[model samples]
Target: MRERPPAAELDAVDRRIVDALQGGFPVCERPYAAAAESLGIAEEELLARLQSLLDRKVLTRFGPMFQIERMGGAFVLAALAVPEADWARVNDAVNAFPEVAHNYRRESDLNTPFNMWFVLATETREGIAEAVRKIEAATGLVVHPFPKLKEYFVEMKLAVRGEALS
Candidate 1:
């Protein structure tokens, strides 16, 4: 993979935007405008900063967080014991599915069987199994699924502030 250029340093406005948006984005017909109003900036400026952040790779993705189970869907944390040589190929093959929400490469202990971990979100419970099967078939590796047995916290948001905002 090509290395990404360093991200540009954020200014006060940019920091404020990130801080404000991270808490919870407005859900309205004019969400951006509402968000900008709360942040004491014009809608256009807020949008421009957001776009710039994305372009500079400061933010990889900007989207709503979903509760799959509440939406009649399911999600599972799965891992694969991928050989070092096949890392790139396996990563690509597993990520090819839309159901694969995110993937991470982690250092494994000597006794650990899996090295690559990922989350699979699907429209239905059965979809999770189907996605695992497809990934197994594509990568020729067993996907060990760790489904949630108990409910806990859903998500966490980090708060960032510029010197001025702070």
Candidate 2:
């Protein structure tokens, strides 16, 4: 993850785009057109601006988040305790799995064996087990699965400083 904020250079329009796009994206044949219409901008301009934002690293990811469980799929949070010497290899091995949604490196004050964490999304519940087994085999480390016991709904949105959503 980038340590620096890309917030310094965003203009009002870019800020609006970032704020507006956090939720309620259109689902239509011409979604961009619809979105651009709502933003009061040309579709082509919206495309160009979005591309520019990505190119400038202002947005690391811009995509839809599927409700895998609702779709009869499963999402499992998994972790691995990887040695410092094998970080690269293990990271590559874990990320190579098609089921991996995203991976992160973390640390704790306690002597925890797990430092590498990731989320796995699979079409079937059994697929989570298969993915964990495959990752363990590939990385020579145990993949700990932590399935969620409860779901919490949190809606997060932010506006640029000195600006408010109208």
Candidate 3:
């Protein structure tokens, strides 16, 4: 983890720069410069501010967020209960698959259970299944791969404007 910057260190310009880039600045060749101009700052200065924000853990990541399905990739939301003693091993195993985006450790009823979750993207269901199989083999645990049943509710929007959302 990177060291966080002091909150008091951030000035109005830094805050504004973070806010402007959060929701997404612009989708053009000169996105940074455009955003900088909007905030009345130089392009290099804005870039440096963004870098500071990142270094301080104010922003985990930056750049374009894609629509996976539109880009011909598949994603499924699933979780696993991993024993505490085995959590590290299981986490590594699940994440070993190329399709696995990320996994997190969460508290659960299952003793020492760390939630192993990921998205498997591929050209077809068979490919996703194959990826899951690889995870299963690596972890030596049966993954309960519960794919999206249907689009019952898919409401995703920016909760806060000018704030980047993962």
- Candidate 2 per-residue lDDT over residues 1-166, each given as its tens digit: 3354435577778888888997788888998899989999999988998999899887767789778898888999988999999989999999999999989888887968899999999998888999999999999998899999997987677765655334
Tens-digit lDDT string for candidate 1 (1-166): 3455654588888877776687578778999999889889999998898999899887877778789899889999999999979988998999899999999877645758688899999999999999999999999999999998997877676655335432
Clashes of each: 0, 0, 1
Clashing pairs in 3: 22-164
What lDDT, from 0 to 1, does candidate 2 have?
Answer: 0.86
After superposition, the stretches of candidate 3 with alpha carbons farther than 4 Å from their true spots are 1-11, 109-114, 123-125, 150-166
lDDT of each: 0.85, 0.86, 0.70
Give the TM-score (vs. native) of candidate 2: 0.83
In the predicted model 1, the residue pairs found to clash are none
lDDT at 68 for candidate 2?
Answer: 88
Q: How close is candidate 1 to the true structure, as a TM-score?
A: 0.84
Which lDDT value does model 2 have at 21?
91
Candidate 1 at residue 150, lDDT? 95
Flag regions of model 1 displaced more than 4 Å. Answer: 1-8, 108-111, 161-166
TM-score of each: 0.84, 0.83, 0.72
CA displacement after TM-score superposition, residue 24 of candidate 3 (Å): 4.2
Whole-model lDDT, model 3:
0.70
Candidate 3 shows a clash count of: 1
